[model samples]
Target: MAPKVTYSDLVIIGAGPAGLMAAAWASRLGLNARILDDKVDRVQTGRADGLHVRTLEILDSFGLANAINEKAYQLREICSWVRAARLPLRAGYADCDKNPDPEDDSKIKRTERVRAKEEEHGRFCQLGIHQGFIEQNFIDFLRREGRLNVERNTATKSLQLDEALMSDHAAYPICLRIGRSTVTMNGDTADQGWRSPQEEIIKARYLVGADGGHSWTRDQVGIRLEGGKTKVHFGVVDIVPITDFPDIRISCSIHSTKTGSTMTFPREDRLVRFYVQLAETGSEGDDFDTSKVTPEMITEKASKILSPYKLSYKHCNWWSVYTVGQQCAPSFSKDGRVFLVGDAVHTHSPTMGAGMNVSMQDSYNLVWKLGQVIKGIAKPDILDTYNAERQSVAQTLIEMDREMCDFYEKGAGSDAHNYDEFYERFRTFLSGVGVEYGPNALVVPAREDGSRDSRSCTDLDKSRQTRGFSRRSLASKIPIGQRLPSFLVLNHSEANIVHVHSVLPADGRWRLLVLAGDISKASQMARLRILCERMDAPSSFLRTYTPEGDKVDSVIEVVTIHAAPRHKVELFSLPELLRPFDPKLGYDYWKCFANNNAGEEGDFDDAYAKWGVDKDEGCLIVIRPDQHVSLVCGLQEVEEVEQFFNTILVPQQRRKATAAACE
Candidate 1:
């Protein structure tokens, strides 16, 4: 029995990166959210400490990237090393000239394992940040910007979800019997912690389980993390190590001859992170207690691994010991109501710092779509895409993590040279920039050599709603189902340069990027005029997706980029529909841009050339709020474009009527 019952639009079960991001986006969409955590406080130290560039860019979209950039250590290069091994240098080792036959030469001679070489490809300088500050940043955003409070020291004891009534627009289908208790405060600053436990029933429309790898929420939801653990063990220590090693400050991996593999990661505030591979001597096949692996043991392990180069530490932040394993839940959501995210859905080795970033991205991809549904701008069917997109990425992560672990911990030192191959192949994945989602309802598949309905848009049969694919040749440079590429485009009116994506925030709005043709041409201008009028129409997606009282740009924003020279175009000459203005703020100068240079700045990005849009005629593209490029078509194919948006964005007018019919 419950003492009290409250309704919330969303209830996030954990306070990790995934949970925080889920709450953040939900808050951004103005949903009633209740985020809870079993822990009394946020992360202290030694959790995930690396954020990829893509994650940072996403945070930048939310205007919260500055906190991490200020607090975290920026790591730019990864130095690599191999143990001393020299039979001779005669093969094709180009450096050895000497030898470099990766496969063939290694077969005959064991080449010299010399000092490490620096890899400059560590571009975009990722952050080696602490999870504590990261969580706090999200908490701050939720509090100040999101206006939502996170309930601490609270845990759900039992979850009961009544089947969601299909027709009920305001129904809270899931019920959670939660227990609230005080977390004992430290005597160093004695305060609260003495409150007795209280039980309450929380009814939520959606439930998220971001409760970490050993997720209690996952268990309660009956989702199985299907995978096996590695026999090898590893330990990580966050300490300001006093070391003689020359490259300790740089991110490096040392494969010692006798001691094993030891990787160093630089952290904020002069602290360094060490991940030492443990030797399985007498403890083979034994179930080891990671808790028993003390700091002394970790230090000794690191000492031996980085031997020859002395290593010791006094001031320590935190340390942990664990065995490597990879597992992914069969599904990310249970009946599309109780969903899992981050470690709850998938757990992998943390060698590349992929865990936290991938988890956060999972939330980034999901909540936007979820927000659309909750806001009555999208159908609930879109929720099915969440599991489809994230699970595929989770599997890719698992495969990569396994390969890296096998090489680092189990490759037996001789395979250290293979690091170059790994780095070359997966550098994009590690950086979080190269992740590509497969095709689904949300992500359209690449079109084969095919034909669309040849019927024109005159006295048309409106029942012809089927969509057809455009020629792939026109979109060679624009990657479908991937994040839109960034390039500078000059604001047509202000003449200021801006990163194409900078104007588009992740606020759950579909961005229609109209790459208009040479608008100075009369024929092209007529086509552009038609496109503008169609978009500004009363029944247009831009208008219908927006609530009656809200602005048209709320759900679908229109931004046009043209290849014409800046000198030839007048800001006022553009049609009102192309550059819609608010009565108070005047016309938006930032919405229209020129592909050509503004002046003698010589910083011309030539986005038209880079994006493969022809100088004479450009194509129209639609980008999802999460930055995924969805549809690409010629300006004339308005029907195909309409079908595309119709598939995703549910018009506001359809909300109540559809709800009533569903019920």
Candidate 2:
């Protein structure tokens, strides 16, 4: 008989980037999640190394970006090259010159020179950190949260999906077999441990395959990965070098025969990573002795690439040789209950530098939807969007890497040798500016203009008409479909400045921020109280001044814009809104309003300057808890918001029909 145990929710197959992120997000959403990996220790050595800007922003959500930035080797710029001798061909930052201006007085003009310098250097550069360091930080975060349990040195031998244990509301039921024992657990549980195959009969409502390219989960689900693999064998060697190549530079060069390519990137702790592509031709199944790749061979290869520049390596830290390949699964999910993410879903050549970022993002996109489904706020079919959204991203990444390989390996004399064009494409891809969701994606509506009065009045005309005498502060009005800007505020008693996120409940509840002036207005306050009660959302009221003779609800935090002498409620002035809200402040403010520069030199001020506003007045904007805008509506349309949520949360009749067909 199989021993059985159950769980609270969620079982992730791998503890790599995708699985780790899934666990972290699940914990943040108040779910009990367990992670299992075959390795005895967290991946502490060689892996992917580049972190893109957008990935940095996502990490910011978890408050890890700043920490990463501090420790990471900032590749703020890159020098291009034709060969070892003519290399470091300085071209101005590609992105800086992309957006040019004519007017001298424009904000764009003020930063143009700086932009030029960065262009001559490189703009929007990626950071180079060992994948091991990133994994360590994530592991530390999970440990600090005290919510994640990682099972090490444990391999999953087999899995069984139980049809009877499955629910009409869930996609599937899974029974997993470990080494010897079977322990039953649902999608939600903190029951993470290593058990024998005999104890493996434990059941789960859902399963995520983040197990990587050689994914056991993918095989268990019978998903075939379809893509051609490359014959190139690349060796990576990390060493603490005693050399004079600027530690800040990432040098990539092609050897004389163009048979091999060598690239170097700086790492923390006086270390550098060297990647050398070995030239060998044989049948597809030919196995080269990768064990022969040593520190001396790597140094010899580096010296050849650097040539006149002279390079050497002494203190070796870690070294490994592995073949490079490209492959991606046709689908990201199978049977609704089993989902594939990260390398399990897609694998590509390392040339494009997108592996780690893409893997983490896959988890990011899926976690929120999964949370909604588990909480019963969204239907099971909502999970279908994950594959639809991420598959395209994976395909694009594969294509980009293929192009990069052609550029690097085929020599500049080839037909694909348009270095300038290739560089432009690289900039655009790395900028994260072009990533757009499909029509089926959820989009937030942004304001149409940057005018201060766009929020309060039904139309801009009325607000403009009364501008001088009764101009409403932007603070007292909330824009539709955009995230509320955060600001620093003193407690209503004028004691301390608290960050807005500090006041938020850690359990992932939605909030309604009310920018009201006088709580003494019994009718308005009553309406707000009723709205809060109906929405089951928390409300915080802010005002410029406290009414001299009115009683306010002490339970709700009441912040004043003016001076005060209390400790409970927060206070902030209008000027604070123009400044970036530090997270240490108790007020949650949007970063869009702080500065127009996106790490670029010039400020290309546009209507979307503060949250990409692009619609007329009297419109209501509803944003997802993740801060992505979901719906835009016309004035006073609470029912529309409710309808939108219902449509998204509940599986449509058509989706239900499809699921029935698949079953």
* Highest-lDDT candidate: 1
Tens-place lDDT per residue, model 2, 400-419, is: 88777766665333344444
Q: For model 2, give the 10-residue run with minimal summed lDDT.
A: 107-116
TM-score of 1: 0.89
Clashing pairs in 1: 92-99, 92-100, 93-99, 93-100, 167-663
Strongest candidate by TM-score: 1
Tell how far residue 407 is off in model 2, in angstroms: 1.3
- Candidate 1 yields a Cα-based lDDT of 0.74
Question: lDDT of all predictions, in order shown?
Answer: 0.74, 0.54
lDDT of 1 by residue, 183-297 (tens): 5644211123433337788988888889899888899878899987767778889989888877778787666544677777899998998888874534434566776788778
